[model samples]
Target: MSNEKRPYKGGHGKPGHAGKPGNGKFSQGNSNQGSGQGEGGAKRKRRRRSGSGAGVNEQNRQQSQNSQRTQNQRSQGRPQKWDDNSRGDKKRFENRGENRNDSRAESRTGRRFDGLTSVERAARRAKTEHDDTKRGGGGTSQRNKSGHERNRRSMSAREFSAAAPSARSRTADTARATVFEVLRSVAESDAYANLVLPKAIRSHRLDHRDAGFATELTYGTLRHQGTYDAILRHCVDRPLEKVGTTTLIVLRMGVHQLLNMRVPAHAALNQSVSLAREKIGAGPASFINAVLRRVSERTPDEWYELIIEDAKDDTERMALLASHPAWIVRSMRQALVAHGRPATEIEQLLEADNLAPVVNLVALPGLGSLDEAREQGAVDGELVEGSALYASGDLARLESVREGTVRAQDAGSQLVARALAAAPLDGTDTAWLDLCAGPGGKAALLGAIGVQRGASLVANEAAPHRAQLVESSMRPLPEDSYTVLTGDGRQIRETLRKNASALPGSIEPGQLFDRVMVDVPCSGLGALRRRPEARWRKSPRDIAELLPLQRQLLDAAIEATRPGGVIAYVTCSPHAAETQNIVAEVLESGAVSLLDSAAALREVALHTEGANGESVSVLAGEKDPGHTPEIKVKKGAPAVKAAENPTTAQLWPHVHGTDAMFLALLRKN
Candidate 1:
């Protein structure tokens, strides 16, 4: 909230003013000055001398000649060409030693005003005044009377150009300004805040602390977007949709600062108002200021109480209090019941999604080492192997990360990939497939392991841009070890056959991969802590649209796996429609059977290291031979009834310190 105010350049120092006519004051001998005269006539005046004797007259004449010589000496080569010899003009020029302001003006424009008419002098003077204003001269500036303004001089011209009335729109450059841009991008372009924010911060050159602040403001505002919009609708006279995207984004960020962050009310309001004035129009900014002022009148908890006082049901009340959509609250409740957990945990689940998650990084096996990461203040992950948790600084600064040997991956994601690699398989296990690999985190880890095992992998992405990301992630591996395919994951059988002939290595028609991972895209509800903007972007319709794709990708994986090979069905979500329901639908086809996924995870977890480099266990001896222990649950926690098919594992952030990742291992029959 840098209140580094800039002076308004009104009337003076405007471009395109050079040749324009001006009021005829101070026109003198310059023709550029328009035709007007002041108290004295527009002519040079001579003063009379008091002399009686002839000798005194002679002395006066000598003095007059001496004065002319002095005037000539004062004019220098860059002479004052104006015929302004009046008393006032002489006084003004005497103060302007060595033709100070006029000389500089002449030097800049390559023209001497002494030879010009009054009108032309007026034009040059106007232009000089304009240039002075641009250089922060002779203009009234607004200043914060409270504390010293930090970064006052560092504030770039573009930062305040919106308020300054520029010829072009300017981008915001402060942390809060970056947050506003990200929010506006989310609303206007349907961009993900998490994806859009980092670039904005980098582009603004925000320091580490400012970058962190920007991240928090962006994620927090998006996390509570529903509640903010509801509150804004109450405050505004019109429907919230009628508000422009820029104003709405500014108001949301303002409300977040006022309610969630410890920023002072004035600081929040002023910063948001300033940002609005800089980004949007003055009218919209005034509206935002008024609405945000009303919003700041009450505490967040008081507003919550007011908002939920008339809730129709407990779910609705919970939704308002926790700032989650009613449908999602109900869905999470149902998911809790489906997984044999207490439905009451839904409240806690809702709260957890609002909190930020620690950044998790995976050091790819063989190619990635953990010692360097540990030296850089990163600790080992709590629930996944070779993963590190670093809460501060740029992760890209790490050499391993820069070299593509390690990456910022979720602990839950790392576990699923390792589970597939750790799962016992019979027959040749040389080929692998990531059916929907895009922005390929898991693919890189798996590719590193593929190189370790002397195997080959195909990382297939449905989009070209994402396929490029997959290629970038797999750069550490030999070019031949992994291939990135761009096509629909649903067409894997045909797509693989088409590429087999030209693809390097043993990949060809009729060759089923030893391991196939169908990490289908879903609502992304589970990873909300990491991607706070997702909570606002998703809806019930998203789940409906995704189910078919999820089913198709899983079915394709089944078709693309060898008879004895294992397929890991994964999602960063716990919705039954996406997880159990989709898996159940594919299993009904009778071509594949479920394996003990929980057991596979247990075996993998045994090798997983905690932050202290100790073997992290879900519980003591949970991986004992011939035994599959249940996940530890509360005493009142409902027991999950074992299904006929092998158990699937659902990891929760509150319980597992990972994203709410769902994993199911299936083997071809």
Candidate 2:
């Protein structure tokens, strides 16, 4: 060899001779050793050799030989010295060939091998690996653990139900289920518990005892929801809003049973947790269990003290303690003072709102009798005539109730309707009107009384559905005794004026009613005891919104009455704006004058004694001799004597055990 290196010839070593396996360098060929060329000539010769078919065939042969050698070494259980490098080179050659085929296939089909795109392939591979890991086929211990966690997280509904509390744990009580369904309906669909509860009780076929239990549980839970939420906030780790609604309702029921009812702590906890697991999920059930455990650590009184400890004032403290909104507390206090009641009674009133009201029933005066109800252990009402207090069970069991001869009516409502019927009117008092009489509890009583007085009643409701209810309520009475009209109460005067001849009754054309009952729509703050959830639903804005309509309806009532006719303005609320203020504004028109409503209520209460001769005294202020004078003024010349208490009557839940119904009797002048 010359001092300068000769240009390389193409081959591993000499033509047709393989290089020594461990040399790590190719052998030089003798074909162009003497006729030497420069580097350029060597490059051109190498390119030509690489592009030739012989070179490709040689590469394939070398790869096959390497694979065969490796296989033979593995089969014979002998380690090959040069196995790593040879195997790697062979794999690279195979991969390159595969890449070319893959490129062509993808270009033609727009997909990779296995008929899947890249994204699809990735997803399929991941799923396959997950399945393998789940089956304990091939994965690390960490991956297997993660797979188990995922499986647990994605458990089916049936599996979760199976994992719930045992069936033998007294968790499937029908009464509790009924209560839960009612609460869920109220929370989810904004349905009234009074409307949904009875139907649910019927559908569940609950007995009298179970019905009573369900009633108490549902009302107690709703009444104390605010207080329970306060206590739950103390027990829970996060805000209550973050909790699921169904879970929160379950917790509320549980708390009510624990603190308010006679239920044992263990029973309450297990039943509530069971309900959660049954209705909600196992995870939420666990959360409820943990929280309820924390709640059971303290007594209800202790929780009350702790929760009210941070109150900024008496109103807020009472709001938390009595389970009422703070604004409602303040409004109640204002209402007490405005309605001639002492402001100190707000606490009693709020506590009363939490108490479940008794089902008050009224027998339609002449056409209905209380014999059926009395035979079934019903006691006479203490607030109004022809009314009874039913505490036994579902009122549906009473034949009179089913016959519409006796209907469920609040005592306050009975008092107002009776007062309106008893109100003195000049000339013939034979024609009456019950404006805004929907779902006709009052209308039924008034119509029955009217039939006895030889009077015809026209019950008007704004909604067609409610008008039907009014008609249904009066079905027990003679069909000719009352007529149900579906129309706006505000337009009653005009409608009558336009169609006076078409009116149903022994009335002359263009004749107005002798008595008109404007039991106007109101915020229903007065009936909170009967509708516990209403406390949370109402706001001051609701009263404000109803003001104009109330005034209009009252005005219409006055206009629709004869000059000497009596108009009874009634509301199931004691809010000043909805009651006294509305009466005052309508009175300012000088078309009507306020009468002694308190005296009328007292008269009605006196004539209507309970079966045991007990009666509720509805008189307040100086009108009531038992009233202790809270404010005393020295006999002086220039003192305004507490603006001589308005003659309007207001029934109180705490005082009379009736809804805080407001009544203002007016006479068209």
Candidate 3:
């Protein structure tokens, strides 16, 4: 018997057994001898270890034969090919017969192969054929691995563009996109457009022309949003509120361009639809297109006439035409009569509010000059000195503006700040306070003047974030000239007292300021032109809520002032409750007496000579002789005579081309 492994010979009944030699099988004696020896013994052992039936033995034998055939084919320089037509070949490939579970037998395409699925095999063959074709081999037309025929003919530019309408049609213009984003932010976050627009402009990297366009679009849409909604109610099938926010904003922008801006109707419609499609979805885009198309059917004047017809009275009519809320229109009328202007001026006032205000720049006193701004195409300001009107483009482009010396401020604001600095004080006029200086526009002006006049300013704000803004605004001035404090303006005395050690020069414990600027938070009714969205956001209830804070801040301002020191009680609103009423209540305390605010403003305005080398009167008195009305004091409170010169001054947009800022100068008694 041999020890070497050998192939199994054919047998009749049992493992490792042979039949008779004469019967085409091995002799029985030889088979018995072989079974007890080397190779035969190994086969017997393997069969015993497997513990399987004769079927398993037959599978192993078939696998061994297939392996031998594959090796022989490979040795002949070509692998064995699969035959789809042969059932035997297919069965041989399917039954791996390895006794182990084979995952490759399960094809992803549900069609089995040796290791790859039928689809994968076809793909590989197509890819090989494509490569051969590229190499100039004799192959069929070029096809992708997925078996799709490739289009080899070149297309003209026009044809190519026509082939992809989505790529060309879905994009929105940068200017319109910027405006839409700003409108969304204003609506969603209750943000001011003035605060959000500049950041958006910079982020969008819009050029000066585009920036101007975006600014107009955003402001115009917001200014006339009430009117646009009125028109939309007629155009849209559903309620305005039911419309998606994105779709509504797009519609508003389109309406503004069509009615108010110089944009052509077709361009407005197409751009707006495109913007809606890109930002929202195609469904909303179609809806927007239909609505805007309906709106464009009528001219702006015709639309205005149509909407005004729905008004029930003169107030509602003015509200619709002026794009102001009816309540706001009534308030403006009442405010005009209360403030000594004729009620008829309400129309003019409302019209002014609709007009976009020019960018008014103020060069910080002593630390800044308007010469640089003037050289850059800024004209001299009409209302105040050291100020310029910038209409060329983005003010941030100016070097002086970026340096924070030249600022974008309203002429009315500049007047109030200068009036406070110019108010006659009896005692040492060294210390000043901005009780509610959150944004620090007035504080910066006051701080700059204080630095020149040997005074220091303490800018206090209730919000920490706005206090940081105050600090940033005053950074361009001398560090020692101003102190930024984060605390309630009503608790200014305590805040200043606690931080005595850290106070700026000569500001000691219990030492009062010579001038206190209490620009208290108000309804912001006056700045409707600058912040158009504010008109919609404000209500009479808001004014009522602000009255208490206004009174408390004014009282705090009076207490912080030394005897004979003047406090400029200011509000960007001319509303009677926030202005005259608040001042009258504070005057009743006998802790302070009203000074001639109109005189102070006149003095500040006239302090700078006009281009003709003579004084120009920018006060409302010059235009409306009865601009000053008698102060409304309580029954027992001391009365201010109407015959006396106007003590408080209200700047009107219609009369002065400025925000309707109200000022009441009070001297501590």
Candidate 4:
């Protein structure tokens, strides 16, 4: 048997390049690492060159520094203002729960949802009526008194009615109006629908049903915008750029409901027209009505087939029919080929992106109990230990989540963190590092695991505000077991190698950690289902730009790892350029050697059990047993090949029921 065998359908790795670690820079030798700016020097200089120079630039820079200072001061105990420069950064803040107001300190009331839609209001009314029906014994006066008490606890009905925009008078219009605002924000400011939708749901007090509707409308419209735009091109007399962004958003929402949602064509049309008339004037409303009427003339399947009929090639046809940009389809195809999987999986991958991902949560080991969560309606996640999949109920209502125990974490993320901690170590295995610990989901899990192992973890995030979030997440763990640092990860190896004061008690001065997790920043293409707006926001240039930083971060992680210890190079991306390419580049440089990451993950899965300690079996071959993706597996493929070691693993949404996470375990020589 040869070493050329693949481990699983989507896992592969190469032996790393043979070289001694110098300074953690990408350059081979005589390296002088740049200052502790988050990104590479070349990238920063490129950004500076794009800006105005000298006096104005210097003045603007000073203002930015001052603003950051004020933000840090305000976010001392809270999550900081979002990073305006990158959508990925904004998402990190949102994931860390830093974007919301201080939960333990601030009141949810008084934060009004000013643009309440009619549909949202109706849902609330129906819920209240149902409650009244359940309490049928109450007399009229008694019921009135009870209603007054409820109003005192929350916003009164009159106040809630007044809070909604006057134009949105219909009871069933709330979700549509909410979708419009979120879509408008995404169009104007590149805000993420996933992040914005939750806040809107909370502020508007949308019940579970209404929230689900808004989510479907928002994600569906954004995901299928390309196909809808193609349809609109044939219908509209003017270019989309000429149409107002608001009107276009409304039209897209109406089109989505008409084509994809269970909503009736007439209801979709009438509600959309009403929305346009209320928000933009009757003239645009008439245009919307005409366009939507034309859109509803055919079913979704018929429309998609017709739209792609004139396509010159299969790729273009798939791109249009699947509602993905052609460039994304191409990139995904290349990514699949590069990762050793059949390139034919791109269609299934793109289709998977359009589908909603299941909500995954992790019960922080020792601090939270998965059994408690399961009792509260969460089903045990089949893949990883201390993980559950729950869809309904407010997460904050759960005691473990509210009290800072279990957190909403993707199973892929939990797997990677656990793999890093559980990787075989020699001698002392008491110190660890999370190099890019933003919003600290992995760090929280690591911290919990560290407590069990009698180890300490140093969680480092470049952004000050994000570091604060890491601190908050790790707060439940023993204080002496972890330390949160606000510094650049690229500087970690040098900083710790020179002076141990940087990380304090987590690691002795000048001593490397036993395990390091380099969850490097990337284009985040793997999590498209969770972050629906991200697919449209990312570009090819993003992958190109991120490659250098990823390489440097991986090098830094290698430099920071003890010789016998291991480093987990993880990314929430399946893009070949950002995942395998980065790993291959580092391996070619000879700084470290690859471990059997697939076997390590298998070990993690095998050892990870339920609350009773019975071994939990995890299947990676297919996501849903009944609905396995139609893969074009070649003939003569082995069901389970042995004697070949694969050092990397790529988890996919369609295959593993997780984000397309890439993990590579490399041990420093």
Best by TM-score: 3
- Model 2 alpha-carbon drift over 4 Å, by segment: 1-171, 497-502, 607-646
Q: Model 3: runs farther than 4 Å from truth?
A: 1-169, 607-616, 624-646
lDDT of 4 by residue, 164-244 (tens): 233344333777778877888898888877768878878788788988899889988988888999899877766887677
Task: Work out the TM-score per prediction.
Answer: 0.71, 0.72, 0.73, 0.69
Count of residue pairs whose backbone atoms collide, per candidate: 16, 1, 0, 13
Residue 473 Cα positional deviation in candidate 1, in Å, after optimal superposition: 0.6
Candidate 3 clashing pairs? none
Q: Per-residue error at 139 for model 1, in Å?
A: 28
Query: Candidate 1's residue-wise lDDT over 543-579, tens digit each?
Result: 9998888887888888889888899999999887887
Residue pairs in steric clash, candidate 2? 13-27
lDDT score at residue 114, model 1, on the 0-100 scale:
76
* Candidate 3 local lDDT, residue 659: 94
lDDT of every predicted structure (CA atoms): 0.74, 0.78, 0.80, 0.73
What's the true lDDT of residue 265 in model 3? 89
Instruction: Report the C-alpha displacement of residue 589, candidate 3, in angstroms.
Output: 2.8
Q: Once superposed on the true structure, which residue ranges of model 1 sit more than 4 Å away at CA?
A: 1-173, 502-508, 606-616, 619-645
Root-mean-square deviation of each candidate, in angstroms?
Answer: 16.5, 12.3, 14.8, 39.4
lDDT comparison, 1 vs 3, better candidate? 3
Tens-digit lDDT string for candidate 2 (1-669): 222234434433225322323344444544344333557657755775676745865775686687677689889999765756586665665687788788988898886647577799888876676566445344223323335422223224332433323332435578888898899889878889999999999999998888889999999999999999999999976589867677788899999998999999999998887787667665567668889999999998899999998999998999999999999999889888887779998888898898888888888877778888788888887656677877777888877788898888888889889989887667989888999999999888888888887888888899998889888998898877777887899999666666565566676666788999999999999888878899888888888889999998988888889887899999998887787777766655566667777777887774434568875453533334121112332343233322234377888889888898888888777
